[model samples]
Each structure stands twice: as C-alpha cells, then as structure tokens.
Target: MAAKPVILQNKACTATYTTRGGALVDFRLQPGGINPLQFRHREKSKGSKEVFFNGHFVCLGNWGDPSAGEATRGHVKHGDFNRLQWLSSQKERQALLSAYSTLEGLYMERNVALDENAAVLQVTETVQNLHTVGRLYNLVQHPTIAAPFLDGETIVDCNATKGFDYAFPQFSENICKTWPCANAFDGETINLSSPDRAYSSVFSFLVNPADEWGWVTAYSPAQQTLLGYVWRRSDYPWISHWLHFEGELIRYRGLEFGTTGLHKPINEIWGKGLVSLLGESTCRFIDTGDTHHRSYLSFLHPLPKGFQGVKQVEVKDNVLVLTEKNTDHTIKISHQFKTKYAIQQ
Candidate 1:
C-alpha cells in the first residue's frame, strides 16, 4: 500500500513528493534538468519494517536508532514518521501533508509551496504533542544528493563554524575543529568542502550563533547549476554532513540539519550528557497539547561558467540573493515567502 508521488510545478522548477513517508522524491529545475536530490537512485538501506530510506525524507521522532527498551516495544530504527503513510492534498503549486506517530503520540502537519517565479520551495512543518505528558523529540530534514549531479567537481559550501567527528576512532569525541576539516578515523585530516574518496565519515557542525539563518549549498560546475537550502538558525542549530562511499566512487551525501547532532539512541544521548555539548541543543521537548513550528527554503540556481563556489546567501524583504565565492558576482530571486527568523534589521 505504498503511496503515489505528487507533482508540484512552477515556471522555474518541478517538485515530486511521495505521500509514503512524505519524502521529496525529485526536485529539478524546469525544462528537463538534473535533480540534485535523487538519493533514492543510490539508496541501499532499509528499516526492518521494509521502508526504504530514499529521497529527501524527514527524520522525525528520532534520528538514528531507538533505545533498547523502545526497540523491545517494536519501535523502528529511525522512528515511525518515515515508515508510516501520510495523507496529502494539493492546490495548484502548494501541498499539505499530515502524518501521525502512534508510538510517540505526536502529530505532524507540513505545508510545501513552490514559488511561481523562482525555483524555490518553501516548507513549514508543525508538530503537536498529543500525549498527556511532555515528550522529547527530534526532527531532521534529510536531503541527500547523488550522482550524476554529485561528482568530484561538485563543491559543498556552508557557514558552519565548529564541529566534531562522529565515528572517528583515533580522535576523542571532545576534539573539535572548524568546518570542512575533520579528523579521519585513521588520524588523518580530511577536507569536506569537496568530494574526496579518501574518507567516508559523518560529521556534525554548529551553525554560527550570531547568524539568524543557516545555509548549505552544492554547486556543480559541470552542469552549471546550484542547489541550496536556508533555514532558521534558532530552529535547526546543527547540520550533519554524511559522506557515503562505495568502492572507489562517492555515492550519497547527506545535508541534514535539525535540533539534534548526536545521532544515537535516547538513553545514550542522555547518559553521556551530550545534549548541550558545543552549546547546541540536541533534543527538543514538547509540552502536552503544545505545538512547535519549523520552516526552511530550498532553491535551485543556474551558475555561470568558472563559478568558484558560494560565498554567502541572504534573504530579505521577500527576496533571496546568492553571492559567488571570491567574487562580487551575485544572483537574486524574488519570492513572497518569509522565514520564521528573518535577518535582523
């Protein structure tokens, strides 16, 4: 009983969203262009419930795994949001999708709208606690990029400041570094801004506390296109970058951002007191009958030849501007959307 995919279109872009788990299956610029978020094509992992981890799915209720006690209660590995079916309705270029997590007694409603004149998708998710008691939760936007949009020539740029490696064996978890430079498991330093098959790792970085918005961009010089996302820094303070490699080729890259950076079971996260490490909150608690809202914007932009990378992204007065790295060149898009935490005037 898998759900069918819904196509939402605009003059500049086309987006396909599947009701099953509410995963975004495809997002490509109009007129037959490359989709950078085609992770389903290279996905090889599935949960015990037979749900495939594909496309750009949200990791709600939890991020990685469930606690031992929760597992014994038949809890799925990454929570029920991605495994359960969601109800959806569409109106023109906007769609509303809703899903419930029976295990956690949480209800989620999402609204996705594509801009009429720009290649930008605006998403807002509202989570409400239905239980009698307060509950802790995690919500992560898992947008994975795969080939042929992802290759050695694709460059990833972000505004992350400090970060720590998750699975590095040689380096202590306390050891920290800035963005794009991480200590590999073999104790070697690896650059993350570009694709490199030298190391496959997962690293989480803290967004600059001073900035109101956090953004990540992937630019492919070969296709002369760029895909990027911007969200409220107050809502998603951490961004986790996962580099999955197979054999001698890079497979998928995860540009995940959420409330939690420690991708472990609940008990471990609390026992180790990794909640406030690096001054970033790992989990959020929702009081009974209370609701929380989070929103973000994802857009596609055409790049000029010899474009080095992204220098900065700015959103103001319902307009988005992107600056090219090491140059004064800029691209601007006009929209009617506003982020929860707009840049301070």
Candidate 2:
C-alpha cells in the first residue's frame, strides 16, 4: 500500500492536504517553525510563516528580512505566526491546533507542487473557531515574489485612480512630479529609479471594512505571462505595499494587502474594541469573527503586443466582474459557510 494516507512527511517538511479542495501541497520546516511553503501566513512576519511558488516567498508576516539591512524602517507583527507564544496556553494551543488541522493540506501539496504545464495554481484556506470566546488579532497573507518574474520591466496598472506612493520623503526634493492620473496622490506609487529612494512599497488600497477583498498580479515580461494572482478578504480596511530590490537578499518584489495601514499596530489602528477577545464583553471592538476567505490562482496568458491598458475588475455581492471594453469574463466563487469564527470579549 502507498503508505497510509496520513499527513505526508519528509525530513524537512510535514503537511496535510484537502482532497476536496486541492490545497496546501507542501509545508516545509524552517529554523523557527513550520513555514507554509505554499501560501504563507498573513500578518507581519514575512516568510517566517509561508513561502510559495517554489521560489515565491510568501512572508505571512510584516516587514522584509531584518538582517538584510532594511531594519531602519518599521515592521508590525500580529499574532498569526506566534506559535511559540500560543504554546503557553492549553486552550489557545488547542484552538490553534484545530485551525491547523482544518487547513493543513493547503500548506503541504498545493503550495509545493509545480505543474509545469499549468499556468495557474489556486489554493483556498478557511479557519473556523468552534470556541465560544471571541478571538482578537490581525491577519495578513504575504507572498515574496522573485525579481526575475517582476523586475524593472514589470508594470502595475490598477483600475483605481489613487494608490499610496512609497518613494516619498527620500525623493521628494528631486523627483516630485504630479502623478499621472487624477487620484495618484504624492503618497501613492513610486518609481525605483529615484535617488535617496531607500525602498518602494505601495499601501493605499481602501478595502471594505465589512468585507474587504482585493487582488495582486505578478507578471513576467520576458515570459509574457502572469506569474500569480493573490486575492484576499477581511474586515480590516488598510493595505500594505512592500518592494525590495537591493542588498544581498533575493531580488524580489511584494505587494501586501491587509486590513490596516502600514506601520500602524493592529491594536492601535483597530483600537482595543476591534481586537478579537477570548471572552464575551461589550467593550468597543471590531470583530471580524465571520469566515474570511482568500485564494491565489496562477494563470498563464500569451503576451500580446503592447497589451497595456486598464482592466476593470471587481467583486460585488459575490459576483466577480472582469471587463475590458466589450470583452468581459465573469466567474462566481461563493461559499455558504466555508469558514466561520466569532470574536468574543
């Protein structure tokens, strides 16, 4: 027999999978703990939580590598990847274990399996809390994309007019030019060519506080294809942008989206009221206890000649709309209650 269908294991990795959802193809071990090599944990720890696309490092936490000479800037940390800290409490550990067991397969197979013939690899993960107490915290999905796939030739075109410009302060004196569009504020979108440009990241996508959702695309000009697509939903409103192209570290770019603004702590931005509590309380807090779902679908498209234009896409009332002039594509990905949780006091 093919070695009981128990969770797959190897010397450097151990992971579970979901036959119903083709999720988590791999969960490799790192020095700290298990990093979801497929789809990393979203918070602030960077790749400490997950790595994707064989080389696409999905840093589920905040900030790039601290030792990579970029620590002068600020990076926030949420409770998502603090497994050692959770080990202190039995209840907390059990709750985390339960959540892990439910989504283990996603980390093992879906993240590690590379189907050379396939252009897109999509994985979905859901975590539900059966406990009665509320859960307070911040969650984010970080994916560190490689430089070869997103180098100087890459271009990002968001249908929206406004975005957060990260190359400010450093280049304000010499490279201050009005943004191309009406909504391109001075704080949105930055070019990497400017001097004094320490680093460039975009964090200005306003999401729905009730159910925030957005997508990030990584395309390879040489290959004339989209490397990946990361779509997420949450109750938080702020999104963070991180771009890295210097130092001895891997030359990769990252566009992280989340519920709160970059550089602001979750507790401070959401306030003590919004924090997910373990117990029931009437205090002011924003509870995103409901099921939050995110998925990444990789697709390969043929390179068209000068195919640069704005593509209008949105998910409204559960319907995904993709419009480009008269050519439009629509897909429906609705779940009844795939993942559920509650925020207690």
Best by lDDT: 1
Error of 2 at 342 (Å): 16
Task: List, residue by residue over 221-285, the lDDT tens digit for candidate 2.
Answer: 54454433435444334344455546534255544444333343433334534232212111122
Candidate 1's displacement at residue 181, Å, is: 1.1
Candidates in order: C-alpha RMSD to true structure: 2.7, 11.6
Q: Tell me model 2's lDDT, rounded to 2 decimals.
A: 0.34
lDDT of 2 at 204: 43
- Listed per model in order, the count of residue pairs whose N, CA or C atoms clash below 3 Å is 0, 55
In model 1, residue pairs whose N, Cα or C atoms come closer than 3 Å (at least 3 residues apart or on different chains), thus clashing, are none
Runs in model 2 deviating more than 4 A are 1-118, 129-133, 159-198, 207-213, 228-239, 247-250, 270-298, 314-345
Residue-wise C-alpha lDDT for candidate 1, range 1-345, written one tens digit per residue: 666777899878899988887889898987878888878742222233444677789888888878877776766656778777889999999999999988978999999999888888999889999989997888888999989988878899888988877885332445678887876666677788885555677888988888888999998888788999999898899988988888767888999888888777767777777667677788888899998988899999887669989888887878888888888688887887865443220
Off by over 4 Å in 1: 41-48, 169-174, 340-345
**Local accuracy by lDDT, each model:** 0.82, 0.34
